[model samples]
Target: MKTITVKRLTEAFQLEVLAGADRMDRVISRPRTHRPGLEFVGYFDFFPMERVQVLGRKEINYLLTLTVEERLLHIGNVVKYHPPCFIVTSGQQEIPYLTLFCDQEGIPLLRTSETTTEFIAKLDGYLLKALAPELSIHGVCVNVSGIGILLRGKSGIGKSETAHTLIRRGHRFVADDIVVLKKLGPSTLLGTHNVTAREFLALRSVGLINVVRQYGRRAFQDETRIVLDIELSPWQENALNNELEVIPQFTEYLGVQIPHIEIQLQPGRDVAGLIEAAANNWYLKQHGYSAVDEFMKRVEDGMQQ
Candidate 1:
């Protein structure tokens, strides 16, 4: 039930208010828009009331063909449905009757200079992002070798410290501390830095430092699609010795399963190097090469020989 107010849309799209200024507070709950071409001729069975109604060149021309009384009757019928708002595209001219009816009914009527197709395309994209499902996770996201790696584990496990080391090695930082994950589609999850902590990393000894300021623009990324999840945990002897003997692991986020791995942490261990190697290994797996699978195949060949 997320909604974007008409006032917000006006500001975002720079829409011109032709009428119904008092209705700027109207809320738009649906990202999809509706074109009332068929409904213009007295068909209301399939008319969508929750979507923003669009009036383009063809719709306006058709309204002109009707006599004043017929036009008013038709427009009044549509207004009775109480749509969220009406947007006029192709901004060539204004239909006085339509504007008047919308004003009287207190329905926001907005005009845009862009063509029908362009306006709809942009509006759909904007709405999709604005209404996409989002969730926050306590982890660190980084872009290593063009692959997004999300590091997750208990606090004090050196997630930020590992990320800092990776940053020094020329990898791009996506987010630290709080990672905001948004479902871009059925299968895609996009991760970005939380607004309050963008480009800032917290360290026990150094306190808070801005990574962007320290490393410049090349060290930071606005967002990245998460492809790998690595969990850092306290070292348990021989816990991961059989990792290569088992099937690869995966973690589910927003209904999509992503490749997952767990790395044990201990003092003096090269955590950053291990993560970097994992990223490279993930890249190779994506391109049809897996070291574990290859090694197992080699063992089978040797046994046969």
Candidate 2:
């Protein structure tokens, strides 16, 4: 997680602190203050966690109107219980006890003349960097029904051409060449295309072109989840000999397991149709139906007979 410091904010905004210069060195995040004086409570809520709190000058005055006991409680909650990075925006207002307590606790107190809006705008990008979701790239992601399908394969295989055919078949596009994968949460993999490279899919003979304009909006998708992984390769005599064979299951992506499938593509095969089959099969599997498994069971019964 990246942190933006007071010095950096000052430099970015070209603003000076009216008070609490000693606190200017504090590193913090963009903390939202619900009300004046309660800003202290918000800071206290995160207690001891390394988070920065920013408050407008008017919010400070609102706190000053509170009873001394209320103010003390806020201070006590933060100073004694929860300590965090504190910042006051639109400076020159003073809270004597707050400053004293901050000094005693060695907590950083910062002030800036910049309005809360301006201050937040400056910290917005940094905050985004800190909050960005993690990503992993193990499977190939294809855009199908606005879903990101990851097609895994060895080099020299026609993954890009298959994707191109899918695009021509009225499916949207995401990443054609390389898909960027990010982990959104537990057991979930997010696949997205590089923004600059998203609109174009590279073929062996033809170069890149904007899929959106060439094939229309239906030819491209914004992004999709990596629900299925189709592994493409030349058909080999020793590779997956049985049409009814059940390959080993893969349930993880970048160490976090997930639902996966491997589809082998060979010469003179309908790759786009196979991809559509994969997508539909995934949907059926999600709903507790496996057409291949059912056929296998029937075949086993017939063999017994």
Candidate 3:
């Protein structure tokens, strides 16, 4: 499980720390936050200790109705679980029960300017992206005709060269050598350039090249959802033969399967054009059409006639 620190979250959201400044190094393992509305009402049986608790206007307003000792008892019962932190939203002025116990219990008590709903939504998005399962693979990721494709094979298999050609033909480049694949949802794998080598393409012929400097901004994308994987291998006369593949293939990454294809490379072959065709074909398949299946149907009908 990926974990983020309380200090980083505070810095990212510019949270005003009312207590537990020394415990800012505490780690948050969960990606979601809890409101603790029930816990505030004397229901601590099922309190979540590890989550970041949020005190919105509703919770704070309810706290106003109780006496100071009752407030302390209620908040204290909830704080004994030792939550990662508490975030008070909606621009609230004070919650002494929270501040006093949070400091004593070594919990980070913070405040945000955004409303409860808005802050929760933003925090969810940030946490989803930051805590997503990540993997780095050796390949070239490019956006050909708006279809994100991954070119994979052994080293020096011309992945970069093919991506260079595709970019020259107006396609957008995503990542060159190492592609970072982040699984945000259950079945979605997003591809992007390596952090250290962002937007830089390495070609064997001319060394390292900056994509934006060479091909302008339109020819590059910050990230793309990988929809297809293409494996390129050197063609051998004995091992290679023309084959009609009607059934679609797939490649798995982080448990998500994506459409896949294998193309053999040889001298005088238009690999970039082939990749473009594959992207168009995949787009057609997405729209309930398959040229290969249609061709086989036509052949069967002719044979029967």
Task: Report the error of model 3 at residue 131, Å.
Answer: 1.6
RMSD of 3: 2.6
Clash totals for all candidate models? 0, 17, 0
Best by TM-score: 3
On a 0 to 1 TM-score scale, where does candidate 3 land against the true structure?
0.88
Task: Name the 10 consecutive residues with the lowest summed lDDT in model 1.
Answer: 238-247
Any idea how many clashes model 1 has? 0
Clashes of 3: 0
Root-mean-square deviation of each candidate, in angstroms? 2.8, 7.1, 2.6
| lDDT of candidates 1 onward, in order | 0.89, 0.65, 0.90
Candidate 1, residues 1-305, lDDT tens digits: the string is 66889999999999999889998999988878989988889998988888999988988999989988899888888888889899999985858887888888899999999999999999987887677788899999999878899999999899999999999999999898899988878888889987889899998889999999999999999899999999999999877666565467899887878888888998899998988888898788779997878899999999999
TM-score of candidate 2 against the unseen true structure: 0.62
Candidate 3, residues 1-305: lDDT per residue as tens digits?
88899999999999999999999999988778889989888777777778788889999998889998888888888888898899999879968768889999999999988999999999987887778888999999999989999999999999999999999999999999899998988778899987788889999979999999998999999889899999999897776545665456788999999887888999999999999998998899789997778989999999999
Better of 1 and 2 by TM-score: 1
Candidate 3 residue pairs in clash (backbone atoms < 3 Å) = none
Off by over 4 Å in 1: 243-246, 283-288, 296-305
TM-score of each: 0.85, 0.62, 0.88
- Pairs in clash, predicted candidate 1: none
Across 111-156, the per-residue lDDT of candidate 2 in tens digits comes to 6776787776766544543344545443345677655678767765
lDDT winner: 3
